[model samples]
Target: MTPLDKIRNFSIIAHIDHGKSTLADRLIQRTGGLSEREMSAQVLDNMDIEKERGITIKAQTVRLEWKGHVLNLMDTPGHVDFAYEVSRSLAACEGALLVVDAAQGVEAQTLANVYQSIEHDHEIIPVINKIDLPSAEPEKVKTEIEEIIGLDASNAVLSSAKSGIGIDEVLDAIVERIPAPKGDPDAPLKAMLVDSWYDPYLGVVILVRVIDGTIRKGQQVKFMATGTTHLIDRVGAFTPKLENLPDLGPGEIGFITAQIKEVAQARVGDTLTDAKKPAAEPLPGFKEVQPVVFCGLFPVDAADFEKLRESISKLRLNDASFSFEMETSAALGFGFRCGFLGLLHLEIIQERLMREYDLDLITTAPSVVYQIELTHGGGHIDLHNPADMPEPNKIETISEPWIQAVIYVPDEYLGSILKLCQDRRGIQQNLTYVGGRAQATYELPLNEVVFDFYDRLKSLSKGYASFDYEQIGYREGDLVKMGILVNEEPVDALSMIVHRSTAETRGRGMVERLKELIPRHMFKIPIQAAIGGKVIARETISALRKDVTAKCYGGDATRKRKLLDKQKKGKAKMREYGSVSIPQEAFIAALRMGDDA
Candidate 1:
């Protein structure tokens, strides 16, 4: 084992596509963590989705040996949805490599993650990445780092990770500048459960950073939060691939298999201690994550409901932040009301369910949690699903979650971005200039921001704008549930809570989109969007008519009139009694209308 003074633990934090993973790949290669034959682009990103999307969904850890010192590096996801992952990774390390795109300078996520590093009291090493690009201005980025992040970047490393530039200098800087972790090996085992995931062969594999004492194979460890003990089956570190180790000592990061059946039991951020001699107190900074978005997930075929449940449970073992509970929809049948970190998280979970488990799913419109204040001295209750919302009569006031967003954009696109925010009922909190770019901060309802807001922001800015947001609590609003009715029957999956001002336009958009999506039937189908008893928007799917008049040929005018009257009567009766057969495709397409609208 390396001495405490010779070990450096650090994580790479950056904005999306700023080359965090590429830097990690270069580090692993330079340190000989993996051979040339085994090396690949984004070597640490092992998942297929991560490779395809070119984004790290989970924070990955690797142990490397450079010169004489032992280096523990974590490659963290840079997207706003995975900020929690970055934070967890930061908690395990004493230093962070703050990567900034030389061309783009400081984006929103760069500031966000760097602030998190500062909060963790990490020694941050500023690295100007993508220096090989023609637009790259390493000096400008260095200034931005100093001005925006308030970190001295005069000695910041200038490198192009793609071309392996400054790789050695980065290593040298890490060893010289980043402080060595200080922990007590003589003390009882106190490891931080940075992350955990399910492994088919060995069960739950936990990634831990040993803070005090050592963790050895066959040692009984207790999870402080869950109050469960498990016998360690294996101890190892990821050299980009699992390599068995005898034990992980203080200031070292590694993995351990404890024969735990589920990852839920090995909670992330939990303290792991020797079962025989438990630590006097668990480590601090542990808090449960509250999901920001909620939606119903149902198998397209009702027969696959049980399979979906099994698949979701298996998925939950991998994602501790995702939460789900059983829910039945009148239109969609059995399903689970699942909560996620954000819109991207919802999409990833849906995609994984379909791809990994081979399950076809129907997802409802995603909505943010609402707080409903009841009338007559009734207590407040958190509303997850709009369909489950209490009656309007009992609701004294409905408050929706709000978020404070920081957007970084070029000055040319500032006007358009501000307009888009205003259209979402946003209130501008502050706006300032950072070099040629504008840093605009706005407080907007989370419900408005959730639907295609990021996509809109990017398009308006020509993909130059970067945004990051955090929940700022709830505020009272004129919120009302808008229910969509097909053939005058309410579709629970299509129901959503909306502000009163935009209800008409949103309702009209949904009804108009549904009119195009739902196929015509023998009887006329009336699609209506309603708020309470008021029908805000309405559309009619014209009936598929037969040529009853054509069969009449050239008869008396009354004969044609009589045939039309009879047909109209028959259609009216069918409209009254006939149930609309809405295909699964319609619901799928209708929910996506929010993005388009």
Candidate 2:
């Protein structure tokens, strides 16, 4: 094992599309972690969805040897939705590489990540990436970093990870500048469970950082959080690929695999210690991540419901942040109501469920958790689904979650971006200019932002804006649950909680979109959006008419009238007895109206 002073553990932090993964690839290549035959783009991004979408969904760790020193590097996701992953990764490291795009300078997420590293008291080394681009402005980015993050950037390393420039400089900086992790080599074995995932060949692979003592094969270890013990079958480190080692010593990051069947046995942020001689106290655990968005995921085929349940359980083994519970919907049948960090997270989980498990799913419209206060001495209840809401008379006030958003945009799009925020009932907190860009902070209801605010903001800024937000608790608002009725029958899957002011417009949009999506039936189908018994918006799908008079071309007027009357009576009877069979495609499309609009 490498000596403590020669060990360096750091995480790569940056905004999305800002070269965090590229920089990691270059470092791995330069250190010869893998041979040319084994090398690939975004080597740390092992999932196909991650590679295809050009995003990192999970934090990846790799250990490398550079100039006789062991460097443990973690590549973290840059998207705000994955900020929990970033924070957890940071907690396992002593320093961070704050990668900033030379052309884009400091973005909202860059600032957010830098602040997280600061919270962790991490030694941050600024690296100006993408210098080979024609529009690269390294010096300006350095200035922006110093001004915004208040970090010394005068000696920042300028490099192009894509072109393999300044790779050695980065390695040297990490070795020389980042402090070595301090731990007692002879103490009881104590390690932090940085992450864990299910491996088909191996039940569960746990990534751990040894803060003190050693973790060895055949050693009995206990998870402090779960109070479960396991005999370590294998201890290894990632050379971008698994490499077995006899043991991991102090200040080293590595993985340990046991014949653990249950995923919950190895919890992220749990402390691991030798079962025979456990540490006096467990290490501080990571903060629990709360799900911000909730939606119902139903199987299109009722028979697949059990398969969906098993799939969700397996998925939870990989992703601890996602949560779900059994819920039965009137329209969608039996399904699971899953909670996620955000919309992107929800999308990824849904996509992974479909791709990995090969299950056909019908996802209900996404909703945010609302706090409902009951009248007169009644207790407050958390509302995850609009259909589960109590009667309006029993509720005192409905409070919706709000978020504090920070956006950075070019000066040209400042006016329009601000307008879009205002149109969503956002209250401007502050607006300031930095060079040719503007930074605006606003507090907006989370429900509004969750629907389509991000998409609208991107379009308004022509995809030049960067946004980051954090939930700022909850506030009482004039929120009402809007229910959709097709042929006077309520659709629980189509219900949503909306602010009173925007209910009509939102409801109108939904009903109009549903009219176009739902196929025409033999009888007219009336779709209405309502708040309680009051209808806010309505649309009708005209029935397909069959001319009964075509056979009687020259019949008498009274005879034609009599035939028409009979036909009208038959149509009225059909309308009363007939039910609208909304296709699965219609539900999916109508639910996405917020995104398309």
Candidate 3:
């Protein structure tokens, strides 16, 4: 068994593109975990999407030996959408390496992660990365970290992962500064499943951090959250690759495959203890994730419905944060309503479904849950889909979700950033200056920022600003459900809930966009946007009529007039009997009209 005092468990947290993976690669190389020939960029980032996008999606754990000490390091995703993943990773570690880009200083996401690590009560070792860049400002960034995060920067390590500079200092700091995992080895087995994924050959493979006692292969284990028990078939450690370990003791991080069939049975943050000698209470800080943004995902072809379901099942095995249920739409046919942590989470899931499963999908406009109070009785319901909203006459009041957004930007762009926030209906709560940069906080509607707020903020700040947000519960708002009609028929997929003041303007924009996207039919197609029974905006696509006169050029005037009259009658009858066929692209365009200027 590995001595508990010799094991140091830690995670690397940072903003996107701050070189967490690169630092991890260097650490592994320095420890002889992998040979120089086997080393590659982002060795821990095994996913192709992660490598291509230069971001970590899932947290990866690797074990390294340095100076006779076992260091287990977890590399976490940097995006706000994957913050929950980072939180889970932190729960498994006793310490954290808060890596910040030297030139960029501290970003919005960096502050968010630093607070999370502090909440976990982990020992935080600050590190300034990318010192090789010509724009690198390690001293400035060190001051920023101290001024912004309230952490002492005197001992913060400065390193460039790309140049192999100060890498030895980082490794030495891990061994000397970070505390070794503390737990009683003789106590009942207690382990936290920080991450889990489904393997076709192994079923559900779980990565767990042993908090106390010991766990071994062939031992019966019970999940404290679900009270489900299964016998472990195999136990191993990640030497960057899965290397079989006879048993995992306290302070060790390893994988366990119990031959479980259901993905839901093995949940992240769930505690695993000996079934025969179960702990009296589960570990603290365990909570199920709640999805914030939701949208309908429909296969473009109905025949791919089963395939979509299977693909989602596989994806769910890896991403437990996302949830879905079978849902059907009148206009878009059968689909699943999937819930995501944020917009990026939604996009990543959709991209994975297409790239991994090769399924064509049509995603409806995303929406947030709204609490509607009944006018007749004081009864209320949470409305997720705008199409499912009750009639306006039956609703007395509506409350939409709100969030507390924290933005970090340079002082020069503060005005533009504030203006963008004000336009999104944000109410400024606090503003402060940190190391020549402005850190602003605002309370805004979650729906307002979930769609296009980040993109707009980046544009206004010239990509110098970083933003993060947390839900602040629902607040009463004047919200109205806006609907779009094609050929005067309501399209369920094109419905959305908007603030009352912007309802008319948003409706007008929707119809105007639809007019441009919808192909002209043989008959005139009328596109309209309505709130309840009141039409706020309208647009028309004139019919694509063929000239009957072109074929009758040689005919007399009387004959031409008679032919034209007959043609007009025929066109009128066609308009009455025909229905417009709206293409898939038109629906996509209409749903995303909110992003248009």
Candidate 4:
């Protein structure tokens, strides 16, 4: 059982809930890498949010030393928002063990990660996980994996990570096949921060793979991006548990702690090297992540805004993917303007913030970007945010984001789903029957998918359909600008883009919805949709004059005026376009509606 010669650096990749963590647990135990006292049902799910949501939001690394070869195992987040995190995990590995669910087969995220693995030029070993399920059909899954992931799965390791069935085969397969990381162990210092976290006690704990040279405790190191160098205080590896490694070099994965207090200090792609003898260059290839879904997140109580801000700051330090900014709206009050990888990413973040930070928040609906057209004099200007929306009678054309969607559903519900797509303004392209199901492709507006898209899919397919999409670029479609006017003033946040075909429908629905959501005020609210200054659709919220007449409590009236002043102050912060007080949530919620039509 010699250590260096048999070491294998591999990561388990899968789509969300495909059981990457469960498989990790079995491998750690099967390799005799951990004791009974150390093994838990899902030992790798160290965070409370992950355990509860049953999803891995962060990447975790552990080592299984077997037959003298140390097999470094990294588990990655299966969701797309964590795709960047997945890429970071891949950078630290020499090979990837793709775990395909035998029953569910391949998904969009599966393709995403496979593309990522190929992009990294990783050696991939396919493993057919979840083979114990009644729906499990290993041969079908194998073929699909090979077809979709463009990988060889002929000798796929079939196993149930839960019962530990055939788990040893998966381990031996990695040892026999996956090669050790190839790098100059004696070269100048260079390392990759695969994933990291902020330990209240230990500061920024980084999981790094030393590509060359060596790093040890108290060594002054430079972080390539932040330029905030620090002296390493501790170095260790997860031998299924924290076993301090004196130093890390080529072909090994381990943890190192710095006196640095924040996750920002240890940027994932930053190269760690001795300032005196740095590597010729850091490992190339790091991408800036952009959030797809934007929404307003606020504490129900204004006092908790600061608390929510602190929580998000701490959380983002560990998760570079999580992004947010302070935002306030007359309709939604004060909260953080947060961006997510997508819808699921949005949900998981909200849930984590609530569960971990223990803050109750009001989340406004989500929205997508709209192309605004402002016709000032004889010229025109296009805008993406409502803040840039044109004033009434001065706008000529407006556009919304669009997409080309492909939905895969069961044969039984094929007809129903097709009809649903058509109803949502989707131009059906082709329907191919694959195996016993149908893969339906269509060109749909991104605005359509921003709202009710998921719910519609579930309804039409009876919940058996699955799909994914990439921005195919926008078209000069029939989109229109709609406004929700409050007190004869347009709220910038509420100015939005809608398909011209549905502009009236959206205007009416949003007005009605807003009227219900908005509290009675001293003024009437009008929700309207206009095409070239033609008011095609409109809704109004009647003003209410409910003043307490209980002797107008002398000093209490002053307190009431202060509260009214605060509310007015809040409303004024929002961008004004026309007469609509469109809150941030209304903007986001409309797009997140996921209803293409």
Report, for every candidate in turn, its global Cα lDDT versus the true structure: 0.91, 0.90, 0.89, 0.73
Write the residue-wise lDDT of candidate 4 on 386-420 in tens digits.
44455556666655555666677888998888877
Q: Which stretches of candidate 2 lie over 4 Å from their true place?
A: 551-557, 595-597
TM-score of 3: 0.94
Count of backbone collisions within predicted model 3: 0
- As for candidate 2, its clashing pairs are none
Q: What is the C-alpha lDDT profile of model 2 across 66-162, one tens digit per residue? A: 9999999988887888776677788889999999999999999888988999999999999999999999999999889988889999999999999
Top candidate when judged by TM-score against the true structure: 1
- Write model 3 residue lDDT over 255-361, tens digit each, in one string: 99999876778888899999999899998878888888999999999999999999998898877788999999888889999999999889889999999999999
| Candidate 3: C-alpha RMSD after superposition | 2.4
Per-prediction TM-score to the true structure, in the order listed: 0.96, 0.95, 0.94, 0.82
Backbone clashes for every candidate come to 0, 0, 0, 37
At residue 438, candidate 4 shows an lDDT of 76
Residue 166 shift from truth in candidate 3, angstroms: 0.8
Candidate 1 per-residue C-alpha lDDT over 1-597 given as tens digits, one digit per residue, 9 for 90 to 100: 669999999998888788989999999999998889999898878888989988888877999998899999988777778776677789999999998889889989888888999999999999999999999899888888888889999999999999999999999999999999989999999999998888889888999999999999999999998899989989999987889999999999999998888777877788999999999999987777789899999999999999999999989988888999999998999999999999888989999999999999999888999988999989999999999888889999988999999999999999999999998999999999979999999999999988778889989999999999988898999999999999989998999999999999999999999899888999999999999899999999999999788877675899998989999999999999999988999899888775465
